[model samples]
Target: MTWDAVIVGSGFGGAMVAHRLISAGARVLMIERGDWVTRGEAAWRPEASFELTPSYARDIPYRCDRGGHGTTIGAVACVGGPSVYYGCVSFRFRELDFVGDADVVADSGAAWPYRYDEIEPFYGEAEGLLGISGDDAGDPTAPRRSRPFPFPPGELAPISMRVVETAVDMGLSPFHLPLAINHTASAARQKCVACRTCDTYACAIEAKNDVATMMIRPLVERGMTLWTNTVALRLEAEGTAVRRLVVHRRDSGEELAVEAERFVLAAGALGSPHLVLASKLDELSPARAAVGRYLMRHDNAMIFGVFPQRPDPTRRFHKQVALHDWYFGDPGAAEGAHLTKLGGVQQMMTPPKELVRAHLPLGTKTLLGGFTEQLTGLLCIAEDQPRKDNGVSVDWSIRDGYGLPQLVIDTSYTARDDLAVDVLARRARQILSNMGALLSYTHRVKTFSHAVGTLRMGTDPETSPLDGDCRFRGVENLWITDGSALPMSAGVNPSLTIAANALRAAAAMVAR
Candidate 1:
C-alpha cells in the first residue's frame, strides 16, 4: 500500500508534519525505528538510568568524538524518539535568533533563509496542539506571540520557588518554564502528579504531553498508519525524485520496500544525514559538500548545589524556573564583553541516589549516596556556533548489524562555545551560592541531546543542503523537517522551533 506521504522518525518534526498532513486529508504512514515505550512502574524506577533501559537503542551505537577520544553513544529510537523522555520544556526561539550574528555567519556560513514572521503563526499552532502551558510576563527574551499560551503556567514547587527567590534577590528576573504537560485535570488525560522521575524517564501516568501522546495517538485514530520497529535503511532515489524507502522490520526480520508520493526525513540531525550518505544522494546533489556539515549542539552543563539540608523534603518535580538575564551580552559586566550570544539557565531536579552512586568513585559513591536529597542543580544551555568540521559522517570500513556503514560523529565545542557556557555556569554557581548552598560542583554535558544543523536550510543551493522550504537541493520529492534543517541553533530549546518549521514545511508540500 503506497502512502500519500511517508515519514521517518516520529519526534517533534515528523509528528508535527504528520499531524498537519493528516489533517489536510493526506494518507500518511510513519516508520519508527523503535516500538512504543511501555509506560509503567518499571519505566519510572529510581534505581535505573533511562540510558540502560530497554527503551533506549543500544544496538545502533554511534561513535562520538570526545576531545580526540572516540566513545560509543547510545541513540534514542522509540516512536516518539527522545520526546518520550524529555522534560517538556517547550520554548520558542527569539526574533534575534532568526538573523544570526554577522561574525557567526562569516565563521560557519549559517543563516536562516526565512524570517521569524514566516513561521510565527505555526508556532502558535504547535503550542496549542501540544497543549503548552506558559506565561510570557516575566520572560524578557520571549518572542512576540500571536496569541497567549494554551494554558497558564502551573504553580511552582517549593524547590523551584527557592531558586526563583534567589534569582529575584540578585536582580535577575526568572520566569516559569513553558512546559508541554497535562497540568490541568481533564477527561482526555490525567494531570501531572509532579513526580521526581521526569527529565529522562517516560511518564508512567501519561501526563507529559509528548509528541507520542499529543500527536501520534490522535493521528492514528484519524486513519494514519504507524509502523513501529521499522528501520529505514536507504531512500531509493531516481534522478531528482525519491522512488521508495527500503526498511527492515525488526520484529519480522524482513526487509520491505515502501513507496510514497512524498518522503519526509525527520530522523534527527545524525540519522537523516547518515541515510542520505548511505543512499549516495550526495552524488546527485549540487550541495553535496554541505550535506553533513555545520553541525551545532548547544554547549550545556549542570551546576549542582550541595545544601546542608534536603532541598526537597517531599521529592516533587521542580524543573521550573528559567533565567535569561545574560542571554545577550551584558556590557556592564567584565566578562560580558566576551559573551555575545549565550543561552539561558533553568532549574534542574536532584538526581536519584542510585544515579549518584553509579557514576561517583568507589568511596565517594557511598558518601554522596546519603546526601542525594541535599543536592539541587541548575542546567546552563548556551548556543554553540556551527563549524564545518563538526558534523556526521558514515564510516565505509565498518558496518553495523544492519550491514550499513557505521555512523561517526565529529563534534567539539569552540572556544566561544566554552566561554559562553563558562559564563552561564559562573552565574548559575552564584545563584546556588545565594540559595545557601555549602558547595557547588559543575558537570559538563557530553551527550548530543540538543543537536541540530547538519542539513541546514538556506537560499543557496551551492552552500546549503536544503532549500529555504526544507526541500533537498536535488531530491524534488524529499523534505527534511527535523533538527537537521535548522540553519542556526538559537539560544533556546529547539523542539518548539522544529515543530513550527515542520508545520510550515508540510503546508508548503500540501499547497504544491
Candidate 2:
C-alpha cells in the first residue's frame, strides 16, 4: 500500500507530525514498534494487575546498558514511547538555547538552524493541543502565550509548597510547573487524580496527555492507520530519495515492505540514530560527520533538604513547581544551572533491613524520620555539551527480538558538563541553607533519562544528518522529528520543543 507519509514511532514527535499531516489531507501510516494498550488497559489504577512493578517497568524499555561513569541510558519501545511513562513536565527551551554560547557553539560543531522565535507559534499550538495546565498570570519570565492554559495548574502538595516558600525566602523565583496534564476533566480527556504513580509509572487516570490519549486517539478517529508491534528494519533508498521501508512484526515474525512518499523518523534520540546506522546509509548519504556522535543526556543531581517542619511527601502528583532562576547564568560565565522539585522526592523509609544496614550511614535509622521533616528538594538539570567521544553505536553482535542490531550507547559527561552540575548543586545548597533547613543530603550526579542529540540538526549537511527543517540531507523524503534532531541539550526538558518542532516539520512537508 502507498502512503502519503509514513511516521516511524508514535511518540510525541511522530504523533504531532502524523496529526498535522492528516489534518492537511495527507494519508498517514504510523508504524510503532510496541504493542498498543486499549484505553481501559492504559489506565493507571493501583488495583490493576500490572501496576507498574520493576519487571513490568522493564517491559516498557526503562533499562539502559550502562557504559563507563555509571551513566545508564535507555529508551521506551511502546506505542506512545517515553511520553507514556514520563513525568509530563513540559518546558520550551529559551531563545539563548537555540543560538547557543559562543564557546559552546564554536565547539558544538553544529547549531540549530532556526531560533526560538521561529518556533514560538508552534509551541503555543502544541501547548493548546496537549492541554497544558499552568498559570500565566504572574510569570513574567514565561514566553508570551497565544492563549491561556486549558486548565489551571495542579494544586501544590505540601512538599512542593514548602519548596516554593523556601525558594521564595531565598530570593529565587518558583512557578507552577507547566505540565502536559489535564488538571480537570475536559471534553477531550479526563483530569488527573493526583496519583503518586507518575515518573516511572503510567497515568491511571488518562490525564497525563501522552500521545496514546491525546494525539493518536484523535488521529485514529480521523481514520489514520497505525501498525503496532511492527519495527522498521531499514530504509530502501534510490539515490537521494527513500522508496520503501522493510518492517518486521514482532508477534508474527513476518517481514513486510511498504512504500511511502515521505517518512518521518521519531524513533527517539538513541533509537533513531541506531536505525540509521543499521541501515548503512552513511556511505550513500554521508551528509553529516556526526550521525550517532555527540549523544547528550542531562547531567542531573538531586539535593534533598530536611527542615524542622513535617511536610507530607506522599501526594500522588507529577510536578508542581520549578526553579528557573539559573536557566541563564551570568552573561559570559562558564557555569549555568536550573532546579525543579521532584514529586516523589523522599527518603526511602522501609528498605529491607539487610540492605538498609549495608548502605545506611552508621546508626542512621534514627536519622530517617528527621530526614523526612522537610522534604523539599531540587533536581539540578544542567546542559551537556556535545562531545565526539560520547555517542550511541549499534552492537552488531547483539540483536534484539526483531533481528535488528541493538543500540549500544557509549556515552559519558565531560568535565565541563560536570562543572555545570556542580554550579547548580552549589546554588541549591546555598538556597537550602538560606531556608534554615537543619539537615540535607545530596545524591551523586547521574545522567537523566532525557536523551538527545544522537542525530543533530545543522546548517551544513557535512556536520549534521538533518537540516533546519529536520529533513535528512541526502534522503529527500526522510526526516527526523524527535529529540535526536536536537543539536544541543538545553538545560530544560525537550518535550514541548519536540512537539513544536514536529509540527513545524510536518507543515513544511505538507507544503512540499
Q: What's the TM-score of every candidate structure?
A: 0.97, 0.86
Global lDDT of each candidate: 0.87, 0.71
Per-residue accuracy of model 2 over 426-451 as CA lDDT, tens digit each: 77776666766676676554443577
Best by lDDT: 1
Off by over 4 Å in 1: 67-70, 359-369
In terms of lDDT, the poorest run of 10 residues in model 1 is: 329-338
Candidate 2 accuracy as TM-score: 0.86
Tens digit of per-residue lDDT, candidate 1, span 357-380:
776667778877778889999999
lDDT of 2: 0.71
Best by TM-score: 1
